[model samples]
Every structure is written in structure tokens, then in C-alpha cells.
Target: MPARLFAVVFGVLLTPSFLLGQVGGDRLIARISRDDANGDGKLTEAEFTGPRRLFETLDGDGDGVLVIEEAAARLAKVRSNVAKAIENRSEEMGNQSQREAIRRRLQETRGGARARVEPDHENIRYGDHERHVFDVYLAETEADEPAPCMIWIHGGGFRRGDKSEGGLFARSFTENGIHYVTLNYRLSQHAIAPACFEDCARALQTIRYNADKWNIDKTRIAIGGGSAGAGLSQWIAFTPDRADPLADDPVLRESTRVSGIILLNAQTSYDYRWIQEHVPGEAWKGDGLQQLFGYDVDRLDEISDAKFELIEECSPLNHLTADDPPMMLFYRRSSDPEIAEKNAMDGIHHPIFGTELKKKADQLGVGCEVFSVENENDMRVYNQRWTMAVDFLKRQFESVQ
Candidate 1:
């Protein structure tokens, strides 16, 4: 209780692997900072358990430098461990028929699977994790013109979701002469925050790396997703360019920038304060943030500086800059009370996220549109919003010239 409470008060659990595994950094600082749950940027006795031995093993020399082979080996182990965890989760579910049904529902809606249509590329692997794959749906698009792409990330609060959930997007975009790609990133059930972002970034990079062969316009790519996926898209589009010119890997060398972004039922900020301030009446009791952060609220009086800073760093609101691409946000303006009653965090999809995001975009002179739906208009409202977003994306793509 005390350990998890430490997280609730401080905000966010430590995740140093993003630094250690991706771009080598101060080994001691990276390892200790992650284990340092209180976020003092230094490890305490209780927090000293993480990354200590792993660093030692990786740093074979008495010198503190991490070697190339060692880093690669470490990353491989991490990927292997994450993949095994997912497999274990599947076995634990113990319901083969239910799982099959979910897979069917993924590629098919009420209208049944889109048969007789085959994707240009299927199960393209972008990373080591099993979920780090994507499907590409290519239109009979113009030969003279490279098709603009829409990469959709699926949303399930970083816990339960798959890229196939966005399978419907393939036909919608492809029919309009745009190539569409739906991707699966690492989920918290197997991995967590940085894993999700890293997977998404790598997938985009992989697409760009193969843009020419795939007939995709590298300059006109648009990103989008729902809920957690939406947050990932915003983080990539708004966050400063992550292109590491110094990295040796070609994929890592590719740019993470996009021409436009679309967000649905988005989370504009991971900050608890932002959630509390913008949410509708009496929605403060939700602990969804804690789950997303993979923490348990301790209701402690004090906070951790490092943890708070990390949370802010991860929040898309904090990443917004003048250079961000145009964005279209879709959300619900109100909640169904009955539905709201079922989930403690029903207001997560509220328009407040879009409302606040619009305010920030206005401040930065970035193009941002917010669409709020108060009632069920059936697929009519969705089609309208989709049309607007696709038009916006097409305009953005054309302007890329």
C-alpha cells in the first residue's frame, strides 16, 4: 500500500528503459531514476532494486560505458519478456471461442468481414513485440500520384485493444483513394507507456522507410487513433521531432513528423490537475489516470518532483509547440448517465479534452478543430466527422507540396 501510494502522490511510475534501451544515456542516472519512484532523481534504499544488476551486466567493462552488443542483447531480452507476458495473458483468459469472436469482431463490424478484398501488405512487423505489427490497405490509387496515408492506432486505455480494431478504416480511406494503415502497439497488459509510444514511432518510421516501394507519400502521412491511440498520435504529432541524426539504425534515422493528426475521444492531458479542472460536474472520483499511469492512488500529502515532471513530459498538452501539424479532434459533449454509472471514469471521453486542446492550439497559432457530439446521430455524425477529417487531411497532404 505504501509503495503504490508513493506513486499516487508522486505521479507516474518510473520507466527508464526508454532512455536506456533506445538512446544510450547516463547509465547510473537512467537506471536509478527509474527505480527512484519518489522521483528525487536518485535511488532510495527501497527503490534501489531496479536496473542495478542489469546495468552491471550490460556494462561489462569496469568503465561505465554500455557496449553495442550488450545494449542489443538487453533490448532483445526486454522484447522477449514482453512477448512472453502477452502469451501468458492469452492463456490465462482460457476462452478460445471468446478470443476467436473478438478477432472476428475486429476485422468485421455488424456488416460482416470485408471479404474478397485483400490488403496490399498484411502483418507487417515494425518491431520485436508480437503486437508491433500493422496492416496496410492500399487503394487502386493514382499511379502518377503517391497515395497519402492514414495510420490509425487502436485505443483500449493501453490495456485491451488491437490494431485490427481500426480495420474498418482501411476501406473508408482506401475507397477515397488514400492508403490506410492500422497498427498495434505494445499494450500495458504486456508493457506500458513508453512502450506504446516507442512502438508507434517505430511503426511510422518503418512505413516511411518503405514509402517508395509502398507508393506512399512520405510527406503527406496523417496519424490518428482512439482513446489511448489518440493520445499516442497527439504525442507524436505535437511532440518535438524525435529524429535522431546520430542513430545508426536506418529506421531510427527516419523522421517521426507527420502532415496532420486526428484524435477521437482523446486525452489531451495526462495531468490529474487538467482532468479535474476540465471534467464535468462530480467526475473527480475517477482513477483511470492511476490505471493508465499503472499506479495506485495512496492519497498521500506529498509529491515527487521527478515523477510529476515525467508525467508533465508525457502529457501532450505540454508538448504543443508552434510547429505542430493541423489536428481534428472528435469527442462527446455529454455523457449518458447510465453508461457513466458503469465506469467510474466516464468523463474521460468528454469534450473538455478537446476544449482545452483547442485553447492551447489557439495560443500557439496551430490549426485545430474540435467536433463534439451530444446525442446519437447514428453513423451519420461519424460519417460527417470522417468526411471533414479526410478533407482536412487531403488539404494538408496537397499543401505538403
Candidate 2:
């Protein structure tokens, strides 16, 4: 489990009173209540299948994996489906308030969509069990040269998300001349932090190992993700030095650095200053965060130091040296006015807190661009973000050529 995630879950379980006033508290509680098994009102393996199915759907490549692009594509589909459902349900109910609520839910559902994707399925080993898998959206593009590749990681706070959710974005990337791969990683209560990261790492290794066959530029691979997955993607770029030397598998031994990165509304740090002031409780327990770090707050200092080591090794911001690859970021408007106002009040310009990071990149002479999606509609935001990202990748790919 990741330490940051551990903090989140710890906050959830230990502070029931505090969570009553949380922004999305009721919805989260309902999800947890319905999904938990054993009448324990907590998540168990049995209760986690809903999220896992979603994850499997996102890993469209049938390579027994999930990547960022595929994950985004899958979520986009869910969003689209939810939106369509709401619209239909709204018309049936014929109530302005009810219809508006459903419409808003649908709008939030497809918060990330722009491309189209078709996934292939397969099975992979999970311990002694064989589980389903998925791969990227490839619609038979016959290129003379290997296509530039991207592997997307989905964000659901490492609990509930899928690569296929990146449907629209994945299709857009592939159409723009980049081969996209999406996959599912082990999630909380099913597996923990390193489990998901290891899954993502393995998927990339599989692609690189089979690059010749897949016609991909093994050297030009890029990684991107939204929210929590974005943090994981950043981990891959930041922790290049921690590449295992004695690992038996070639992919495990390989470095995780990519030629570039695309981040959207990522939670960049876990210093606990802001969350402590605002959330100040333990109602977030049994959430995906605890599963990632493998520890609670009591052991956090030791874990924090250890994770800081990992952070130094894995944070892209730390590796913002001249040799680092070009990076692009997108920030969408926060749904909550208070959160949005806090951002403005604090001078925290970008939703992902990339303003300072961009400045650092400029000083280092590394190329970095930042874009903000002004719209609240998921489709429009997805369209704008993908356009900007595709343009950036075109330039990067052309520069290398």
C-alpha cells in the first residue's frame, strides 16, 4: 500500500464524526455500505468485485493488463452509459429536480471522454487463479514504422477504477499515431500499493519485451493518468533509479522512465498539512489508501521517511532535470465551490498544483506546458484536454524523428 493512501483510509475509519460533514461523504458511505460484505460494514474481497469488473473492462488489450489510456477509455464508457441512463431516466421521471440530479450525475460520469476504443480480452494468473484481462484500442492501423506508444493508468483512488474508462481518450491517442495500452492493476482489499504499481510495471515490461512484434517504439513510451493514477504514473517517472538489478524478470529489471508524461488533476504530494487542517479525522479508513502503504498513521513517520526515499526516487517533480522528458498537465475545475475557492485563496493556481512545477521546468530548460480546461462538462473537458495532449505528443514524436 502507498503511504498517502494509508493516510486517506486511516482518516476514514478512525473519524466517523468528522466525515458527517465531508463533501462527498454520503455518497461514499452509501457505496461502502452497499459494497461491504460479512455484515461488517467494511470492504472485503467479496465486496470488491464491482470495482474489479470495472478494472477488467478497462484493460482492453486482452494482454492480461491495464494501462492509463485504456483505463481512461473504460471510465469514459461508464460515464457515457451513466449519462445516457440518466437522460433516459430523467425523461421518465418528468421532475425537474430529479431530472437535474440525474443529468448532473451523468455529466460527472463521463468526466473523461474524447476518443473511442474497442478492447480485446484474455486471462492472466492472479496467484494460483486465472483472471480476465484487457488491452489497448487498436483498430488495425498498419503503419510502416512502429507507432509511438502510450500506456494509461486509471485513477479511482486505487479502489474503484478501470483502464477502459479512458475509452474516448484512448481512441483519440491511437488515432493520433500513438499506440495506446490500458490495463487493470490489483486494487485495495484485493491487493495493495506495490501490487497495482507492479501490475502497471509488468504491463509496460510486457509491451517492451514484445515491442518488435507489436511494432512500437520501446524507447519512446509515454505514461499518463488522471488523479490517483496520475500519482502512480508520476511514481514510475520519479523512481527510475530504484530499478531492480537482480530481478529475474527483464521487465522488473527495466527502468520505468518514459519519454514524456501527461497528468490530470493529480494529487501531487502527501505532506498532510492541508488534509489535516480540513478533513481532520479517521472516517476514511478501509479506503484504498490504507491498502497501498500497508500501515496506518502510527507507523507513518517511519513509513513517511521510507516513502520519502521512494518519493525522491519516484516523484517526477524531483527528477525535473534537463534530461527529463517533456511533460504536459491539465487541470479541470473542481466540482465543489469551497475547494475551488480555497485553490484561489491559496494562490494554488492549477488544480494539480503544477504552477510551481512548471516554473521549475522552465528554469531547468526542460519543456513543460500547462493547460486548464475551463468547462465543467465532462465531454467538453475531455475534448479540450485530449486535443492539447495530442498536439504535444505530435510535436514530441516529430522532434525525435
For each candidate in the order shown, give its overall lDDT on alpha carbons: 0.66, 0.55
Give lDDT: candidate 2, residue 223. Answer: 86
Q: Tell me, by lDDT, which candidate is best.
A: 1
Candidate 1 per-residue lDDT over residues 303-389, each given as its tens digit: 477656766777898899999998998763353444333333446666677878889899999999887656567324643666777
Worst 10 residues of 1 by lDDT: 6-15
For model 1, the stretches where C-alpha displacement exceeds 4 angstroms are: 1-118, 281-288, 299-303, 335-343, 375-380
Work out how many backbone clashes candidate 1 has.
0
Error in Å for residue 120 of model 1: 2.5
Q: What TM-score number comes out for model 1?
A: 0.67
